[model samples]
Target: MAEQQKEMSFLGHLEELRWHLVRSVAAIFILAITFFAFAEQVYDHFLLAHIKPDFITYQLFCDAFQLFGIDSAFCNVSFADKKLQSIKVTSQLMNSIWSSLILGLIVSFPYLLWEIWRFVAPGLTAHEIKKSKGFIFIASFLFFIGVLFSFYVIAPISIHFLYNYQITDAIENSFTLESHIGLVTNMLLGVSILFELPVLIYFLTKIGLITPEFLKKYRKHALVVVLILAAIITPPDVASQVIVAIPILILYEIGISVSRRVIKKQEKNANKS
Candidate 1:
């Protein structure tokens, strides 16, 4: 009877999880359909906006150059014969569908996080759930901030640098639509997840896998790794790499602080218990 009760309980949890997942999927699909309905605006003003020479970043660079009384590449207003091509017949349709889904995922991130939290909250102690009351909000905020950072700073810089780079006069710089979208989407997703470092650290600390001392002791090594990661993710330029690395380093520091706080809280709670 006890074994049967355990099985039923497990089945009930699974049923609850299924509903949460179903709701999350429905939200994503709804948002994706909405994005698809306005795909042109999304493609123009959001995705391909950085390809223009007069993008906000370039304008800022132009202003900075003028302030220094120097000639600037920012004045170069034309991309060299850059047109996006789709080699396969279904490529455009597939790309559009995937892009819409990506946009949906981004837009619905907070709600998705909420659903996940709701699903998991029942299993957690009341105190634990209370302790993490702001998790969804903070995580969503960090994610959106990271996405903006990627879109405004990293994506534009990377696109401009790569589009302008030339090895020989023989090669032209016509990019495929898939390639361009892939780069933008990957950077957006990657940076947003990277910004979750503090939250990840909190959980790790709670589970006793990490401590403040471990993070502090390896801080220098972490810096080097962060720089390398930034170099890998951003354009092959010092400025771009530095811009990407700074936020990640800050996140690492924040993660260390979060770990320390979690440890302290756990210690206090233990003493009280």
Candidate 2:
């Protein structure tokens, strides 16, 4: 009888998890449909904005150089004639659907985190639940910050450099729509995930997978990894790589502090027990 009851409980948990996943997917689907409905505006105002020569990042760079009484390539850049080609018959339609889905996932991230919290809250103590009350908001904030940073700063610079760069005057830069969108989406998703390092550290610390001392001890190694990641994500330029690495290194330090706090809390709880 007890074995049958245990099996039923296991199945019940799975059912509950399935429902949570269903709701998350439904949220993404609804938002994706809405974005697809306004695909033209979304692409023009948001996704493709970085490709323009007059993007905010370029303008900021121009202005900064001017303020310092220096001439900059940013001031001379122009993208009025550059256009993305649709090489495949279904490229536009497919990219529209995929971009809408990615946007949907990004916009619904907080709600998805809420759903995850709801599912996991049942297994946590009151103290743990209270401690994590702001998890969704904090995580969502970091994610959006990363998105904006990549879209405005990283994407514009990368697009400008890659689209204009030529080994010689003979080779023309004609890029496909798929390639352009792929780069933007990948950077947006990748950097956003990277920004979750502190949250990930909190969980890892709570589970005893890593400690603050371990993080500090390997800080130099982490710097090398961060530089490599920056190189992968940013344009092949020292300035771009440095800009990307700074924030990630800051986040790593923040993660170390978070891990220390988690250790302190766990020790306190152990004493009470």
Candidate 3:
């Protein structure tokens, strides 16, 4: 079993943790300032890109459907005159600041993970630490992939469907700036965190809190939960829900493999000892 190198006083641990948190915050602050400098461009080009009818995702969807000789609704939608409303006087400025901060956190995630690992490494056994050397890179890669998947695939589809859906022609769709930003950022961050399932499962297995058999037994329940999560994150449409659920289900399967590997390694170590 892995063991701590040495015991540290409670205050000593707290102090070390404080410094790691401070550095992490400083990195986020620096990136936030940089993003704020180019706030307009970031908002227009990246954050609000889906609002445009000709965004690459929509075009991709159009092309994909065209390959089947089928027409896609994405190609027919237009957002030329549509504008997100700013009801409050401080809405724009506040939303911009918050959005930049969120972007900073997202961009600086790898650094944040490194800081966390540094803080935790001191208490871990050398073997454990060495084995986890790729934690930061792997976690960051999964997170960024999740962000891209959500942004390019889920976000635009949900946005277009929700924005265009109306009960009657008498009612017009007017989305607020704050609401729009909230939706975008939530989906980006939320899905990114969800992508850490395999990592989380690895640790859980290492701690003996869960095993491969347990995960396999609960596979059906996991599917139901994934579907529920998909419903929450996506617009109220079967196609959108299925689209979101597929990746999460894939992650859950990956987590199962991770758990199995962890159990096999543990058994091998036990036999060797």
User: Relative to the true structure, how large is the alpha-carbon lDDT of every model?
Assistant: 0.88, 0.90, 0.90
Worst 10 residues of 1 by lDDT: 73-82
The RMSD of every model to the true structure, in order and in angstroms, is 1.7, 1.3, 3.3
Would you list the clashing residue pairs of candidate 1? none
Residue 97 lDDT, candidate 3, scale 0-100: 91
Q: Compared with the true structure, what per-residue lDDT tens digits does model 3 show for residues 1-273?
A: 123423456667888899999999999999999989999999999889999988999999998999999998987979876799999999989988999999999999999999999998988999989988999999999999999999999899989988888999999888899888888898899888888889999999999999989999999999998888877776688877898788888999999999999899989999999
Candidates 1 and 2 compared: the better one by lDDT is 2
Q: Per TM-score, what order, best first?
A: 2, 3, 1
Model 3 scores a C-alpha lDDT of: 0.90
Model 1 lDDT per residue over 1-273, tens place: 999999999999999999999999999999999988988998989888888777898888788899999998876756647788899999888998999999899889999999999988988998879977899999999999999999988998788888888899998777899999988988888788888888888889989998999999999998899888877766678987888889989999999999999889889989999
lDDT of 1: 0.88
Q: Backbone clashes in each candidate structure, one number apiece? A: 0, 0, 0
Q: What lDDT does candidate 3 reach at residue 50?
A: 91
Clashing pairs in 3: none
TM per candidate: 0.93, 0.96, 0.95
